[model samples]
Target: MQYDFDKIILRNGTNAIKWDGLDKTFGAADILPMWIADMDFEAPQPVIDAVVNRAQHGIYGYTEKPESFYSSISNWMKKRHGWQIDNKWIEVSAGVVPAISLSILSYSEPGDKILLQSPVYYPFFSAIESNNRVMVNNQLIYENHQYKIDFNDLESKLKTGVKVIILCNPHNPVGRVWSREELEKIGELCIRYNVIIVSDEIHSDLIFGKHTHIPIASISEELAERTVTCMAPSKTFNIAGLYTSAVIISDDTLRGEFKNTMNRLNAEAKNLFGIIALEAAYTYGEEWLEQALPYLEGNLDFLVDYFITKIPNIKVSKPQGTYLAWLDCKELGMNQKDLVDFFIHKA
Candidate 1:
């Protein structure tokens, strides 16, 4: 069945932050709100059906992650990425950001150094620092309109007694799906330095064209022992509001510590609707994704071509995965503040 990708749905007054809360968020209600990562499109029909069915039952009580939840996650991982994971490895969390913060709290002390690739998802900075951990930057190298890991800098930073390194697998803001070779180099360094890796693989399912997302833990047994992978149906199925995500930890010790943290913080309880939506999404959302991906690719193509013809100065760094397009606006001769104002106020 073909999904309607061209249909425009009115999200205003739906409590959607991207549409309804625009005035509060961006100081203008009329401005098109494209800041949040949430998709404008509705989630899969099956997901909607499941959520609505659950709501119709009337009692919204505390929910638990059932055996089927783990099965859905494990099966989806294997089917989509060729990564086979056991049910025990999956731990349900409220969201990816919360999982990251919990992992930071669980694995590292307040003064310990936590590493991140610079220009990553902004929340990562807060996740590390807000926990009183020092944030270290192993910046990515941008060359030829593509982003590459500065392995030398990464290794050097790791050597300085870093306790944890947060990795954005298909990096955000700059979307290069890290190749196996790149992941291997990173894995080797983490192993050598005894650094725990918290990999945010939230965008793992949104690959474009021939690009493949290799779960860093799926690389090797050694890597899996130290890696905590954060994944969710939220990004894939446009269900971010559900706040349901999974943190896959193969290591028993790490899993125990992370779960302990969750329990201590009273955050282990799963959202009822989120659980229903997640299971439905994982079980039946693939057809929707299959259609959505090509539509997104077409959108990307249009943006690239449009930039070439109309906005040549704002070069587009075409992504290998995810729907985000990174625009390089250095050629526009505007400083950061002016450029932001240009897009926010003047454009």
Candidate 2:
């Protein structure tokens, strides 16, 4: 059950976007890819074995998700996060980013205002703007070397006919595992403003230290009814290429609309290997994750301490969850262009 997370794996020749496509993405092949969210470790052995076993059957066809797929998700949510969900609440998606677009299509119209916390995951910006929706920002406040939700700004934005707000629980880039109190405040505002919450909980499994990731919907039944929570085994198991994710919607009408969007987009068909890997990951990858978390935590600690000791000008925001870190390089006295050059050409 002990996973060797310290073992370095070569991903260069593989079609991994994080490694193989770096030259095309960053304009230099030599640049280290610390940008993409996918991890550098190998997936859980059980997941690999399950996919290999499935591939050995020697038939690739349109695959239907088995009952085990639904059960694995439902059970994993209940056991890991203490969030009880019915199998019926689960809907299929290839990825969380795509699911976000689907939710925007399902619940809001073109030109409808959608809110986001600034400095969030970049794709969130694209999901709203590309769909022709008005993008609104309620930027997070940075104080005392940490990030905090600007609840006042959030509430003010929500009041402006904002039809949807995409919340990043255990927020990306900034790395705040939202507390229950913060989630409740967001829930209360959404309820008051009649805005739907599309919560991206993809990083829920990778929390660190004393911080617990509370699924925003789990706080209250009222919150659950309006929240469309997107999650996947992809990030937890480093299977992002497999492209399997789930959208859990408790409200019957909301679920139906999301399903309708999926059907309209012809996106309900699950990937053959993705399904096998997902089921294996949720059912048997916990021990692998239990090991990976400590490794990740150790990595975070090293990064933070290294910055303090060696790279004094670059302050690191020690995350409460997820492997991603937010680095502040303002004290280095570089402009945006200089910073890009420093990381790409010098660092």
TM-score of each model, in listed order: 0.98, 0.98
Q: List the residue pairs that clash in candidate 2.
A: none
lDDT of 2 at 253: 96
Candidate 2 wrong stretches, greater than 4 Å: none
Instruction: Tally clashing residue pairs in candidate 1.
Output: 0
- TM-score attained by model 1: 0.98
lDDT of each: 0.92, 0.93
lDDT of 1 at 19: 89
Write down the lDDT that model 2 would get.
0.93
Model 1 pairs in collision: none
Q: lDDT tens digits, residues 49-155, model 1?
A: 99999899999987667899899999999999999999999998889999999999999998999999978899999998899999999998989889999998898
Superposing all C-alpha atoms, what RMSD in Å does each candidate have to the true structure?
0.9, 0.9
**Residue range 276-307, candidate 2, lDDT tens digits:** 99999999999999999998999999999999
